[model samples]
Target: MSLQPDQAIEVFYSYAHEDEKVRDKLEKHLTLLRREGVITEWHDRKIGAGKEWQNEIDTHLNSSQIILLLVSANFIASDYCWDVEVKRAMERHETKEARVIPIILDFVDWESAPFGRLQALPEGGRAVKKWGNRDAAFLSVAQGIRIVAKELAVSS
Candidate 1:
């Protein structure tokens, strides 16, 4: 079940526009994995100039092996993230088609949210913004993603 050397795990990012900075920070931490070809990251910013945004997003969402939800008050309030992306991520997760990881980027009461029961990143649901060193938080997330990617490779 090992992945081919050139086979990159597809990771789709779901976040609110308000959380873009945090998402960008998190993406920075994933550069190593991306360069190593362990994962291929996708976000709305990657949409082509002529592509229909929603259709492009849905294509990536449906094909992603992993989905990262950047959780925040704004993200929770976002209709597209909460109603659409999260819903689709959950469906894929439940069907064993993809794994979903929710990373808390800001203080938010998301324990009652759809992905609440799942384990979150930065350890113990700590918000990345609240971390003493933000890089440490992103590092924790990166390590967790590495573990999941390895597991997925093995299982596949």
Candidate 2:
């Protein structure tokens, strides 16, 4: 699974619509990696008009090397997030086809969730919203994702 220097690792953003703003902030923090060709991210918002959204989502979810689960109360409450996206993301992670990292955006009782066993971002699984300085929180998340991106580039 060696990535060519020019091939940025594909990142699939699986999150509830309520978390878009926070997701965008994280994306902004990831600007350096995107600019340096380390990763490319895809989410539902990128789906073109007239496209089948579900099919498009499934396509990226199945193909991407990294699946980012943006977690929060709203995210967990969404049936689609809990049932389809999380279910498939965990399946891929278990098979070694992709890396699934949970990004805790808001505090939630998620220790029993399917992705609970995997390491979460933002340093110590602190909710991004609970941070005193939001940029600092995003920075922690971006750095962690950067590490995962580099790992995916190495021997596998």
TM-score of 2: 0.95
RMSD of 1: 1.8
lDDT of 1 by residue, 1-156 (tens): 234555779999999998888888899999888878789899999998999999999999999999999999999999999889999999999999999999999989999988999999988789998999999999999999999998887787
Candidate 2 per-residue lDDT over residues 75-103, each given as its tens digit: 99999999999999999999999999999
- Which ranges of candidate 1 are over 4 A from the true structure? 1-6
Which residue pairs collide in model 1, if any?
A: none
lDDT of every predicted structure (CA atoms): 0.91, 0.91
